[model samples]
Target: MIGVSVIGAGFWARQMHLPALAQLPGVRITSVVATSPESAQRAAAPYDEAQALTDIAEAAADPDTHVLDIVAPPDVHLPAVEIAAAHGKHAICIKPLARDLDEADRMLEAVDEAGTRLFYAENVPFIPALQEARQLVDAGDIGTVFRVKACEGIGEPHSPWFFDPDRSGGGAILDMAVHSLEFCRFFAKAPITAVYAEAGTFVHHDRTTAEDTAVLTLRFANGVIGQCEDSWSLQGAMDSRFEVFGTEGRILVDNLHRQPLQVVNARAGWSYPMPIAGLVADGHLAMLGHFLDCLRSGAPSLSDGHVGRDVLAVVDAAYRSVASGRREEIKETTR
Candidate 1:
């Protein structure tokens, strides 16, 4: 069994990772590190035999901890990973790995030098709906995927740092685009050749320096085209929709509003509390389970740091395209 040190007690940490990790076999959270000692303690209250602390160094240095699961913000990711590397612990980090390519390179270098098993925590491709869609595509139900359009638009995030460019990278594009960018690559099985993007702060203009909305056109090396849309201004429920067009057929998976179990009431109005989409479908458990399996059997996660870097590379080009007002060629990375 791999003992896990969970870094960050934020929303994703509490709502997703912790709950999922709690149920997975062969993995146990030994420690919890958060923004504050109190927060860490609060986060650890549900888990038996788990210690709480404010310092990642302490968590990583713990002999009982074999894996460092980082659910921290974008800015803190590399530093946490560095601690994990220094301690020679296996790591699973959330996506948009670093602020930029340089930071990502440094983190990759550190982990490589330490020989740490680093896995990028990207759960989009692991979602049941998306997995089924991929299976169909792989089986030639969609003969040759020529075009893909993926969109994720939700209201403002729960955290304040999500609005800051320096802390969270770019706004909607950086926060939500990573999902579509990575999943598009997964579906197409091709590297992005170029990207053209347009973004603006129509909403939340006064609230943040980053763009609140963005649309990117991605050209794959294998002649497939991808359209990615991201926004933080959508009203009401979130939109997690994808449309893939192939030579023989088409597939659409509206993951956001796919409510397998719905409820209606005169007092409370119609609602779907337990939506069968995204992490609610146990994607996080599947991801963590896969990582633990990798740790035990010497396999590799489907979404590793290299895959995360490549997706970031596309986002990097998209930001450049936003500035240049033209299609930007994706820079080749050695990793």
Candidate 2:
């Protein structure tokens, strides 16, 4: 069996990762790690063999832990991944890989030196509708794609850390926009050259220091104009949409609005907190399946560390553009 250490006893771990783990046969949850034993134990309660621990190093160093499944916030990702790599363990780090470029670089370096895989847990590509959309765009059904737009909006995140810049690294841009930004890259399939962003804490000033609303413009090498809007002031409703404009035809996707069949398995701990939770759940499972396949076959992952770093670079560039009040070049980010 492939032993797994899920290193966060939070919402994502309980609601998202655990149910997915239940469906997979060969993997076992060896540990549930958290900042406190109570949280860890609460999260690990369903799995009989899972050990509750506060020390991440102990979990990573375990002989049975082949992978450290990190579901923590952006702040803990690097340290958790670093510890995993130090013990020669593969890791699955969730979206928005780092706060900045240097941290992303160190993550890549550690994994490279350890000769282990760092699977970036970016699930947007695994969305069923988006996958079909990508296929059509690639097959020339949309002719030469030129303009891409994507947006994801939510009222507020369940956790307070998302509002805490010290924990989350950035606001709506880094949190929700990363999804849309990665989707933009997914459609463009080219290097982003420059990015301009307008972001501020428009509504949630009392809640967070980070921006609650933002828009990002991306200039791709292939001349694709990619724009992303992410927001947290949508009241209680959630909205997600993607549009691709092309010479011959156009494709538009609204993933959250409707679905033919939806499920809410309370016993399974899979509840529909967000309107798109069903789709997101499927994406999470599909993404995990792909990573497990990579682990077993010793193959490359579609959303690997390199891809994560690339996305982070764009995010970093967006923040820079906000600071400079001009389009920032991704290549100039090193300076």
Of candidate 2, the 10-residue stretch with the lowest lDDT total is 262-271
Q: Candidate 1 residues 265-319, lDDT tens each?
A: 5654445677453454637878888888888889867978888788888889999
What lDDT score is found at residue 294 in candidate 1? 82
In model 1, which runs have C-alpha deviations exceeding 4 angstroms? 260-272, 275-282
Models, CA RMSD each: 2.5, 3.7
**How would you encode candidate 2's per-residue C-alpha lDDT over 97-189 as one tens digit per residue?**
877678888999999899999999888888888899999988999899999999898777878999999889989888888899888889988
Q: lDDT of all predictions, in order shown? A: 0.86, 0.86
Worst 10 residues of 1 by lDDT: 274-283
Segments of candidate 2 deviating more than 4 angstroms:
259-282, 332-335
TM-score of each: 0.95, 0.92
Best by TM-score: 1
